[model samples]
Target: MYVGLVGCGLVGNKRARGLGSNHRLAAVADKDLTRAESLASQHSGCDYFADWQAVVGHPACEVIIVATTNDTLAEVATAAIDRNRPVLIEKPAARNSKEIEPLIEIAERNGVPVKVGFNHRFHPALIQARQIWDTGELGDLMYIRGRYGHGGRLGYEKEWRADPRIAGGGELLDQGVHLIDLSRWFAGEFADVDGYVNTYFWRMPVEDNAFMLLKTIAQQVAWLHVSCTEWKNLFSFEIFGRNGKLQIDGLGGSYGTERLTYYQMSPEMGPPATVISEYPESDDSWEMEFAYFIDCIQHGCEPQGNLKDAKAALRIVEALYEKHTSGKSVRL
Candidate 1:
């Protein structure tokens, strides 16, 4: 794949790195031309552009990676799709579900696939948990609980994420979508959504903290929380099944060592059986997800984190925001 990346920020660089030797970084674009040039310089023959249109229109570019801010995601993706190019768009895909609908429609019309960057699904621990759950040993899933947060740095409130126009929503649309996507991965679509979001710490229009309780028609539940106010960075996700429980913690780096613990209920019911898996090294989810996207394109298969998944998660987000803005909060 000849990749063209837009954004040239941390995520854009990560996507370029993920491409590695297996693919080519043919072009890159960002609002900051210097940043685009810096990334493009790292790869031989890679071009830099100030406008994303040039990046997507590059004659040699076969794949597009849109890692821009929330507001521009859908616009760039739609442009790429218009050219019949497959795009790997960063999540929350867009500012809202409505913003992403045109991109999805364009992708389908062009016979191109739009892969959303829900990289958490590619985490080694979560992948293993999903595989195990698929074996039916855990029986029926009951509920899932997820907590993901990070401590903001100095001047965090002034970042693009703190701006409602740029970020769409606060932590909920940011990290919260990951939890919502993961919860859907385990328990399926959430038919009911109730949540509360508030700017408890950050001095921004967007909320710094959000709490959600989602339930499926099957009665399976997902309780999730995301925040930018946590003094200590954290990532914890627990899934309860009829026969056992799977708990995943951390996300490597500042969140600490990523690990998964499985507790199976034995007939005797005391202590049961326990198994643990830990990823003590760096995070490879970026590369893994990129590989999956490549495979999907090659095989003409539907991707795990396609536009539908992004839209589903975004729907929950919009619902929560609607509830919050309507002066309804703190409900079960």
Candidate 2:
């Protein structure tokens, strides 16, 4: 399938390499001509353009990938779907659903489908976690906990991510969106969600740290703590169940870098059961996610990370934003 790229920034470049494979990089565009050319030149037959509309409008490009900032994701996605092209937009979908919901409505009106990129669900470790849950190996889940963030924008005054208007926020929207989605995925739909966020350490406009409390539909509670100010850490998720607990220690790539371990009670009754661990050596979340989208496009199947999932995840963000600003609990 021929694909077009809208941005050549860090995530765009990384996905261009990882998602490139045998798929056609028919066209590419970026606000920066230099960056577009640099990335386009890496693969043959990839046309370059300065304006994103040009890339998405190219007749030869069958699919469009929107990797621009949160500000332009909705605009790019809406236009692409209008042209009857399927699209894969990077996370958060938009700064808020206000910016993206219309695109969802537009796609629905046109009978077209666009996918929001939530690559975490495609991770090997997450895949195993889901399998364990389905198999009842971990029994009924009790709680879900996660931590995901970085110190990439530590001292930036002019970074787009530091600006709430551009990035939405630091911990919650920027990185915590992944954990928020993961929390819902592991613990089921949230019965209630309430949280706190703060701006600290860095002199940025958005909150850099956040903590959330959630209860699943069954009243099983979970905690999601995320921070963008942490200088040297990564992402991880732990699931507590009736029988034991499962923890996944790596969120290194679009695919993960760890295994699923079960800490069950030992037969001796006084000690813990043997901790049995299972590892799926392959970590190709990027490839796996893109392949799933390809399948969705090819089979006319609804996407796993479709626009609907994107909206559901962003709803939590909206609630968090309302709560943070209003200093009152907001219902989802």
Candidate 3:
């Protein structure tokens, strides 16, 4: 596959690497021409464009990867989908679901496949967790609890992430979206969402910490928190079910070693039987998601990270933000 990549920053580069040896980077684009050129230079026969539009319409490219800031995700993806090109857009999909609705309409009308970048779903531990749940050993799911946070670096408040206009909502829209997506994956779509967001530590207009409560039609609840105030980086997610429970911790690197544990309740139940799995290498979720994207394109199937999933996550996000802004409860 020939690819047109936009952003040329941390995530964009990761996407490029994820394409691996089978796919070619036909063109790269960034607001900074130098950054685009730098990425393009790494691959022979690759082209660099100053404007993202050029890369979007580049003749040699069959797929589009949008890794730009949150605000540009929908705009660039909508454009690419308008041209009948398949797109793997980095998530939130846009600043909010409102920005993504039109893009979804466009994609459905044109039958163009759109994949959102919720790469965490592809992590080995998560993949195993999903498999275990699918076997029905967990019985009916009860609730999920997740805590994800990171310590910000020097001058963090001044980054583009600090600007609500550029990055949309703060921690909720950032790492929080991953937790929301995971909850939905295990428990199905949420029917009610409520939350609080506050700039407890950062000086930015956007909140540095966020708390959420999501409930499904079945009353399966997810209580989650995401923050940048944690002095020690952390990631923990626990799911409880009638017959068993699953706990996933860390995400490799600064998040520590990735691991998942499943506790199955015996019928006579004194102590539950526990199973553990660990992933010690660098995160390959990027590569796994890319492979899934390619398979979806080949099989004419919608991706697991399709626009619908992104919309669902955004719905929860918007609901939470509404609750925070209005200081009232949010239903649906």
**Candidates 1 and 2 compared by lDDT, better number:** 1
| Residue lDDT tens for model 3, 1-332 | 99999999999999999997899999999999999999999999999988999999999999999999998999999899999999999988899988999999999999998899999999999999999999998998899999999989999999989998999989889999999999988888888888788898888899899999888888889999999998899999999999999999999999999999999999998899999999999988998899899899999998887888999899888999899878886787
Worst 10 residues of 2 by lDDT: 251-260
User: What's the CA error at residue 129 for candidate 2, in Å?
Assistant: 1.0
Best candidate, lDDT? 3
Candidate 3's clash total is 0
Candidate 3 regions off by >4 Å? Answer: none
Candidate 2 matches the true fold with a TM-score of 0.93
Q: For residues 29-109, could you state the per-residue lDDT of candidate 1 as single tens digits?
A: 999999999999999999999999999899999999999998899989998899989899999999998998888788878
lDDT of each: 0.91, 0.80, 0.92
User: Residue 296 in model 2: shift from native, Å?
Assistant: 1.4
Compare candidates 2 and 3 on TM-score and give the better one. Answer: 3
Estimated TM-score for each candidate: 0.98, 0.93, 0.98
- In lDDT terms, how accurate is model 2? 0.80
Assess the local accuracy of residue 60 in candidate 3 as a C-alpha lDDT between 0 and 100. Answer: 95
* Candidate 3 lDDT score at position 65: 98
User: Where is the poorest 10-residue window by lDDT in model 1?
Assistant: 323-332
